[model samples]
Target: MTRVKISRVTKVPASEAPPASGECPPSGIRLTTDDGDAAMGLRVVGIHLENCGKQDYSVDGYPLLELMDKDLSPVQGISIVQGSGGISTGTGFDEPARPLVLKPGESALSGLMWRNTTESGPTANIPYVRVRAKQGADPVTVTPQLDLGTTGKLAVRPWTRPSK
Candidate 1:
């Protein structure tokens, strides 16, 4: 779904390598990814959860994706629907999840729509995505390459507080 490239994420640009910006992982939170945005076929990716570590940091729902494949393993059949369970329709990803708390440096926002459009079989170019800012929290691998042409499905949008 990234054959269009629109780009638009003002922050979350702190990187030190760890597969590509997602370093802070001692429960401090810091996952970045936003070089994604396509049009007509829908495909937006933006997952920046930054807390820099100090104290307060919480999450509510939908931030536990897997889909890895640049030698990171874990890619099986896709299908990670949470908000836009309807595939896609107006962008907001169907909208629903609410509950967050980041302090220290504060920053929270999540998203990952999909559509890619293909018609045959076999097509899920996910370069890596191991995020997990919920349910036990502690697993960030950021790098939303995801092309998912066959449309295996991947729509997550929760954890707000980033209208930039």
Candidate 2:
């Protein structure tokens, strides 16, 4: 059955950035499946990079997602995976790469999914997630932050394969 529902919500972070101690950001990020696309028998997913706070700039660093518990605790031992380059469907290319650098007042969408490996099988005690970018780049810093809304929480699902 196809169902369309418009849910309205507003979320605000307690702070624009995390403290200087490296802690998980608060629970403000939300993930919702694109049922409309999936309903058409597609493997497409949508990720919303909501309010990531204010930062001077961002650049040059690998972004990663960290999973946490309901009490706002790290879910020790879990890997998150994401992909952006579009895939082929036997005819032609559907998505093309054209620089996905998002600035303030901007958001990016791509095909992404999360799985828990701290021990398998659909679990849903998600609390919050943080995005970490490695330090030291070049002219600008690309160090990802846990409060940038760039990181997303792990869906309450288990993994089918191990990340090595």
Candidates in order, TM-scores: namely: 0.33, 0.34
Cα lDDT, model 1, residue 108: 86
What lDDT is reached at residue 95 by model 1?
Answer: 66
RMSD of 2: 12.9
Q: Model-by-model lDDT, in order? A: 0.76, 0.32
Q: How well does model 1 score by local distance difference test?
A: 0.76
| Per-residue C-alpha lDDT of model 2 across residues 11-46, encoded as one tens digit per residue | 224352333332323432222223213322223333
| lDDT of model 1 at position 101 | 79
lDDT of 2 at 128: 50
Please list the residue runs of candidate 2 whose C-alpha ends up more than 4 Å from where it truly belongs after superposition. Answer: 1-13, 16-45, 50-62, 84-99, 102-106, 114-124, 132-164
Looking at candidate 1, the ten consecutive residues that score lowest on lDDT are 8-17
